[model samples]
Target: MQNHHMITPCLWFDDQAEAAAQFYTSVFRNSKILNISRYGEAGQEIHGKPAGTVMTVSFELNGQPFTALNGGPTFKFNEAISFQIFCDTQEEVDDYWQKLSAGGDETAQQCGWLKDQYGVSWQIIPRILIELLNHSDAATAQRVTTAMLQMKKIDIDELKQVAASQ
Candidate 1:
């Protein structure tokens, strides 16, 4: 069986790939562990495993498939790629921002971009970012951006204050 349009986001971990995958699947609703498979032979000692360690694990997050691979310490999650959460309200933003920022790094950018404890980046953006960017002028948008550059979690009121400034 296969879903033609299902494309899973693969994650790489030093040795905690399975643990992290389970954690994520547990945190999100409409989610569960789909499958877990160890390496065949190619990824044996290369991954500090017996050649059949956890080569890959498929999980679901909010019904989305995500694969985690224990590929050793060759690569680590950096700030390059980040997941953006489009939230409908400030409360939603606060909830996710707080949860993701637990033991994570807050970049204090114009929007909501932070690195979680596992070094995985997340953007707790409001769904209004697109609307705000569309409706406002560059000058006003610049002000909002300026305000946002000062803090994290993106307080809607604070962003409005910047947008309203002359």
Candidate 2:
């Protein structure tokens, strides 16, 4: 923790903090579990978790620090907050899309957005999409946007075709 980021996201889960941490670490490269703290009798009255149960798990995903807490089902994750993964190539995008969306809500997939099994929303975006969307020609950008709006996982080749047509 010598040069940690200024902010780290802390996820709230009912009782899957450790499982979630392990799953996330497995999904991303350059990731690992940093620490784990279990519940103790000190806060038994309020927390209500049994002693020795996982309380918080500190982990890293592709070098980004995150903490998962077994804070009960008081709050749940929604689409309001999401993590965006910017990919440089179609292979990168496809790899992430397949891995992160496994067992997730298929109904939530749209425009490169998906909800994982834990209800955490993620946006798997490609760098080419951003470039096309910001093209100098408004018409070309519009076409790219229109094409993108119709899909779930982004297809870099298809987007390039659309951009070229315009």
Candidate 3:
């Protein structure tokens, strides 16, 4: 059978699959929950989840497919893996940064990286940062890189200022 989504990233949650899916869909535009699967009695012994409880949530965020699984507490999210949000303006960067880092670990934020309340690592980056860093001039790129390293939420204006100062 042909599948709509070929490779979906699965997020392992400790009984928070549905809640997480709801939150994610709310954050991005053109996103919604597509389907849900509940635990069954057949897997009670190994899974330990009660029948009818949410086992998995299939959802989309800005057209990207993802699955949140109530896989117990066997795994947790870390910074090793992260999702990048490329924004065209500073407003977009600020909006995502504020929403995603509302109750996140403050200490973990650096270089446009933040850990959300669910411990999901996200990078809120502006498109200009990429262009600046990949500029033909090496010194300008270094300056912008230094500025970015000192910031938690990337500032498009600051990056622009740094790039032009040289």
Candidate 4:
């Protein structure tokens, strides 16, 4: 086990901490559930969860440490925060897009962003996108950006084509 960073992103869930942790671990390589802390009688009145129920689940996704808390329905996930997965190839982008959006809200999907079944937002991006978007010529970058804006799951070939066209 490796020592993780002091600051880890904590995900708030409504009794789905364990399930979301399992799902995320299965999706990413080199990921696993590190620990689980259960609720206790000490804070039963305030938490309202069963004593043995999960309170927090510490996990890792692709070496990034994350904590999921079963904090009840007091809060909900929104687009304000999202996890971005950068892929080196189109295949990698497609694979991650398909897997992450499987049970997600299709309507919320645009420009490679989607809200998963757990309501967590994710962005599946290609590395080439950054290069294209940062090209020396502003026109080329603008073309790529325009193509991306019209897409749900980004198409690397389309971006390449737009960049190549006059």
Candidate 5:
């Protein structure tokens, strides 16, 4: 059980660390490149790769830390568990929705999940999800869950209204 906030997603790529880091930092506010390191001589012989190849690159997206590892094409990011971002308003959600889906695809899950060009999964959920989940009634949570299943990029106000109803 990994805590979402405490974790810094380490993404593996086929030599796209710099490019991917640049792209991601440009999209989100409060995002910046932390550091970048190339394969030193010690790393070259052990891994059997080139000496100057990119080893890792770190970046923060909206204060959340992430590391992009240039570890070749051995592994990939699947839709198993994704980073769920809490957006304050529809504009914030829409901005991320557009940028993230720029070279990616969109699904109809009420802004729950999307896969970026690097095959990274992200959940663009609204801030209301926390409120709904934190509600006193489990039934409300269930209702909100059911409603979320029918859409993508969740509408916060709609969920609030739904929770207020039967």
Candidate 6:
């Protein structure tokens, strides 16, 4: 087991903490489930979940530690928070987008952002996007930004073409 960080992002789930943890670990490299803590009798009384049920699942996605709490549906995931995955190539971006968005809300996809089946928002972005959007030339940056705004999965080739155009 690796040492945990002082601050970790905890995802709240209704009763799918384990499933979500597994799914996330499978998608990201160097990721795995670290530990699973079950609810005790006292905890069950307070949380209303049955004793021995999953209380929290600690996992790592690409070495980034995260915790999934099976805390009832009192709160839901929204676009206020999202995970950003940076990719060096279009194939990398496409793979992640396809896996994360599988069975997710397709309608929520916009500008390289999508809501997963668990309602968690994620941004599959190409690394070159920053370079293009932060180009020394303001006009070039604007062109890249304009092209990105009209995309959903983010086509790096298209963005490159747009940047090369006059």
Worst 10 residues of 2 by lDDT: 1-10
| Global Cα lDDT for candidate 3 | 0.92
Model 1, 98-119: lDDT tens per residue? 7777776655333588777678
What is the per-residue lDDT of model 6 for residues 1-166, given as tens digits with 9 covering 90 to 100? 6665788899999999999999999999999999999988885557999889998999999888999999998999999999999999989999999999999999999999999999999999899998999999999999999999999999999999999998
Query: For model 5, how does the per-residue alpha-carbon lDDT over 80-161 read when each residue is reduced to its tens digit?
Result: 8677667888888888778886777554234468888777777887777877977889999988888887767677778888
Give a tens-digit lDDT track for model 4, residues 1-166: 5554977999999999999999999999999999999999897789999899999999999889999999999999999999999999899988888888888899999998998999999999998899999999999999999999999998989999998986
lDDT of 4 at 78: 96
**Candidate 2 wrongly placed segments (more than 4 Å):** 1-3
TM for candidate 4 is 0.97
lDDT of 2 by residue, 1-166 (tens): 4536999999999999999999999989999999999999997999999999999999999889999999999999999999999999999998999988999999999999999999999999999899999999999999999999999999999999999993
Residue-level lDDT of model 3, residues 85-142, one tens digit each, is 9999888998999999989999999999999999999999899999999989999999
Candidate 4, position 65, lDDT: 95
lDDT of each: 0.75, 0.95, 0.92, 0.92, 0.79, 0.95
TM-score of each: 0.84, 0.97, 0.97, 0.97, 0.80, 0.97
Model 2 quality (TM-score): 0.97
**Which pairs of residues collide in candidate 5?**
109-151, 109-152, 110-151, 110-152, 110-153, 111-152, 111-153
- Which residue pairs show backbone clashes in model 4? none
For model 1, the run of ten residues with the poorest summed lDDT: 102-111
